[model samples]
Target: MTGRIVRWGAVLGLGSVWWWAVLRLVLAPDAGALEGAVAAGGWGLSLLPVHCAPKSRAGARGVARWRHAWRSAATKASPRPRSDGGSGPS
Candidate 1:
C-alpha cells in the first residue's frame, strides 16, 4: 500500500511538472533554451516509472505472488457477513 502511494505520488508530481513545462512552451513561443531543456527533461523524467517497471518473467511472477499474498491477507483479516444478515447478536 505504501509503495503504491509513493509510486502514484511520483507519477503525479512528475506529470504535473511535465504539463507545466509544456504549458509554458505553448504560452511563450519565444521560450529560452533553458525552458526547452526543462520541458524535455520533465517529459523524460515522467516516463521513468514506465522505464523502470518490471519486465522479466521472474519479476512478473514475483509481482503476481505479492499481489496474491496481499489479497489473501486482506481477505483473512476482514470481517465476514452473517448468513442471517443481522448487524449484531441479540
Candidate 2:
C-alpha cells in the first residue's frame, strides 16, 4: 500500500508541475492563478516526498509519517484461533 501511495503521490506531483506551467504561463498569467496552483500543489503534490522517503530517513520518523505501524499493532492485539481445539472467527 505504501508503494501504491507513493506511486500516486509521484503522479500527482508531476501533474502539479505541469499544471503550474499551463496555469501560470499560458492560461491566465494575471487572473489569480496562483491560488489554484498553490492549492493543487499543496494538497496533491506536497505529501509525495514524505511517503517516498526511506524507513531510516528523517522524514519517515515523525508523527506525520505513514501509518504502517497501525496494521502490525492491530494484528498483535487481535486474537487468533487455537491450533489445539479452540475455534475463532470464521
Candidate 3:
C-alpha cells in the first residue's frame, strides 16, 4: 500500500540521515565539510554541527531522558495483538 511505502521511506530516510550525522560527527575533523555539501546541494544550512565535546553533565542527562522518552513513546504507539482463536477452534 502507498501508506506502507511512505512509512518505510520515512524510516529509511531518517535512518540514513542519522547515520550520516554520526559519520560526520565522528570521522570528519570539520563539520563544515558536511555543511558545505549541504550548501552545495542547495540546502541553506547543514544539520551537522560540531558536537565533539559535551556541553555539560546536564546535557548528557538530557540526552538520556530524551532517549527514554522516545523508547516509551514507541512502546505506546506499537500495535496491540488480535485474538484469532487459531485453527478454527480445533
Candidate 4:
C-alpha cells in the first residue's frame, strides 16, 4: 500500500513539473527552469531505475525519490482524496 502511494505520488509530481514547464514555455520564459526540471527528473529517475523488484540500493533510492517528488506535488493542503465520482444521481 505504501509503495502504491509512492508510485502515484512520483508520477503526479513529474506531471506537475511538466505542467509548469508547459506554462513557462507558453509565457516565453527562460528555458533554464524547464531544462532544469527535465534534467533533474531524468537524472533522478535514472538513479534508482525501478524494475520488477527493487533489489538494488539504487532502485530503492530511486523509488523513494520518486515517491517524495510525487507527494510534494500532491495536495498537502487537503490530504483527503476528493470524491468527484459524478454530480448526477442514479
Candidate 5:
C-alpha cells in the first residue's frame, strides 16, 4: 500500500521536473535551454522503471519475502544440520 503511494509520488516528482524543463525550454528559446531540457528528460525517464514495470517489481518483492519466510521456517523446523552431517555439534 505504502509502496504504491511512494512509487506514484516518484512518478509525479519526475514528471514535474520533465514538464518544467520542457516549459523552460519552450519559453526561453536559448541554446542552453535545450541542454537543460535534455538532462531533465533523462531524469524524468528514470522514473519509468517504477511506472513501466510495476508487476515485475512487485513480483520481485514477493519472491524476496517468500525466500525469507522459507529460510526462517527451515531453521526452526529442526536444529540446523552440521556441515559434516553429524547428529550434534562437536
Candidate 6:
C-alpha cells in the first residue's frame, strides 16, 4: 500500500514538473538558459526512480517471496475458528 502511494506520488510529481516547464517555455519564448537547464534537470531527476528499480530476475523472485511471506504471516495472526462452533461465550 505504501509502495503504491510512493510510486503514484513520483508519477504525479514528474507530470507536474513537465507541465510547468512546457507552460513556462510556451508562455515566455525569451526564457533564459537557467530555466531550460532546470527543466532538463527535472526530467533527468524524474527518471531516477525508474533507473533505480530492481532489474534482475532474482530481485523479482525476492519481491514475490516477500509478498507471500507477508500474506502467510497475516493469516497466521488472524482469529481462529472455535472448536465447538459456538458464537456466544461458554
Best by TM-score: 1
Q: lDDT tens string, model 4, 55-88?
A: 5743555777889978887846656555975556
Query: Model 1, range 15-38, lDDT digits (tens) per residue?
Result: 776677778888988777777787
TM-score of 1: 0.44
lDDT of 6 at 49: 58
Candidate 6: tens digits of C-alpha lDDT, residues 1-90:
999999999989977867777678778888777667768887787677554555584365577788999999998886889898878876
Candidate 3 accuracy as TM-score: 0.35
Root-mean-square deviation of candidate 2: 14.7
User: Against the hidden reference, what TM-scores do the models get?
Assistant: 0.44, 0.29, 0.35, 0.35, 0.38, 0.40
lDDT of each: 0.78, 0.66, 0.65, 0.70, 0.73, 0.77
What's the true lDDT of residue 6 in model 5?
100
Off by over 4 Å in 4: 31-33, 36-90
Model 5 bad stretches (over 4 Å): 29-40, 43-90
lDDT of 1 at 21: 71
**Per-candidate clashes, comma-separated:** 0, 0, 0, 1, 0, 0
Q: Ten residues in a row with the worst lDDT in model 6? A: 49-58
lDDT of 2 by residue, 1-90 (tens): 999999999988877766675567555657466656665656675567654656576445555443567766777885765789766679
The reply for model 3, stretches above 4 Å from the true place, is 32-90
* Root-mean-square deviation (CA) per prediction: 11.7, 14.7, 18.7, 20.0, 12.0, 12.5
Tens digits of per-residue lDDT for model 3, 45-83: 344553556658435557788899999999888576567
Displacement of residue 66 (Cα, Å) in model 4 is 41
What is the lDDT for 36 in model 5? 88
Residue-wise lDDT of candidate 5 within 1-90, one digit each (tens)? 999999999989977767767666677766385658676767766777554556676565577788999998988876767788857556
Query: Cα RMSD (Å) between model 6 and the true structure?
Result: 12.5
The 10 consecutive residues of candidate 1 with the worst lDDT sum are 50-59
User: Which is better, 1 or 3, measured by TM-score?
Assistant: 1
